[model samples]
Target: MNDTFTEADLAPDPQEKRDRLLAVADRVAALVAVLAGGVYIGGMIALGAGAAPIVFSMLPRSIAGDVMGAIFARFDAVALGAALAVLAAEVTRMVAARRRGRTILSRLRRSCTLFMAVCAAYVALSLSPRINDLHRQGVQRDDTPQGQVLEAVHKRAELFGKIGMGMAFGLVVLSVFTIQPRRAEDEEDDDEAAAPLPPGPRDD
Candidate 1:
């Protein structure tokens, strides 16, 4: 019997090829989302930690207030962009999984992504400007009812930013867990495909 093998014989099935392509795309998207989340969190940390010393020690109060405002505005812009990118990637992954009839995708991840995006938008568009305005007012009028209001706004914005960063980190952790299972499943499938079938008993 001829036992010659051709490239056609070794070629992957079309559906399997497509599935693998989609799996790779999903993995790439997840990685991007994680990276963006990291950027978002890192920027928040820098805004809180690095900017403070510069604002307080290196500059006068008026200049410091303006500098801090500009710094926060820029940080918010970058963080908002990163959050939106992560949200888009996560939504695309969810839609692709649903289209592929995959039941392994976690709904919690989607919820977290949505929440993070909303929080980021709110902070960037609304809270950031309000906080800057209050900072200016506090610098101008430090011992009045308006100053008390400034303190309140400061506390609220700080809490919201903290919550948003926490959500971003949570999404990263969830993505890691979700993708790990898929990686293991892919490896197991590859191993099974490579394993040889046992020989059947020969007929006499």
Candidate 2:
């Protein structure tokens, strides 16, 4: 090797490469969760003005027949159930991890759990009013510019729901790597901690 050649140019260790890959995977999984949250929130805000409920709290019986009601109502509850299911899954993951004495990263991905919860909440909240509106006011209600914008919003909410699910799944898969197996040293520690207090209640 000549002075022109540098140590930095040497090949990287295989373990180091694997570590880098895992780090990148963790980061990417978190980013996906963030994006999923953004899409859901943006969609609800955009669509609530125009479409009303896009996926929950209401069921659309028809669309073109009632024109405004028919078209807008179609969006009321299509994806609502799926959104709720996702939320439930997230909540279960979080609660279960704590009770099991494990960190979220140990078996469940926290980023994914958070993304699911937020997205689910957004969908549920967004749909509740529209469901109420549809029942209170028939589909024939007047269509405003707000209604027009909301049409897009509902659609975006639906898209985000799918994306959120995908992100959550990816993060869950990644958590396998974060789950550390119990080592002999850990077993020894547990044994040491479990040794009974020396019948000190009477003496102390």
Candidate 3:
């Protein structure tokens, strides 16, 4: 084997690894934020539309009821999963941020947290009336009250969705700053951690 040596091959560079990892983390964080924002917006828009969602009837045995029931059962899970993703993405981004200075990410995190709360409220409000209806022995079938509650939920969903979009855009703004040349302290530590070794001989 030929004898050739370079600083890159000699030792494990922690800072380089950190830098690379940070870059990857930044990209992934941004992607997650964008997706979360889109989902939030879409969900909100649907909530705002006040349209009854239709599902294909599989069987004639109360097909509409079955589909509606299924949708209700699954809806919360879907929203919960989306909110969880945003929360997870925020946590991951926080971990990925290497150096000092809190930026728009903090605001984004707050926005995401609020968004999750809004989703939770939506789920809770949607179910409360149903639960109450079931509890009453001979309650009338009027769903006006339920509709009112649902409307309120829809409003929150739409508002939070817009807020999430703003926060996600803010994250993008902060990330742009991070990509620039780091401060001297940031540079100093990494550079000192892995100083160049003056001309060394190969000893494999």
Ordering by TM-score: 1, 3, 2
Q: Candidate 3's residue-wise lDDT over 1-204, tens digit each? A: 856887768564798677667767766775775576566546545643432343333444235333444444455565566667667766676677644326555654556455564544455456533533432323222466755554454455446545644554454455444442444665776797699656779676
User: Which clashing pairs does model 3 show?
Assistant: none
Misplaced by over 4 Å in model 2 are 1-108, 131-136, 139-147, 185-204
Give lDDT per model, in order: 0.76, 0.48, 0.53
Error of 2 at 186 (Å): 6.6
C-alpha positional error of residue 104 in candidate 3 after TM-score superposition, expressed in Å: 3.9
Clashes of each: 0, 11, 0
Q: Which numbered prediction scores highest in lDDT against the true structure?
A: 1
RMSD of each: 4.5, 15.3, 8.8
Lowest lDDT 10-residue stretch of candidate 1:
96-105
Cα error, candidate 2, residue 81 (Å): 11
Task: For model 2, state the Cα shift of residue 126 in Å.
Answer: 2.2
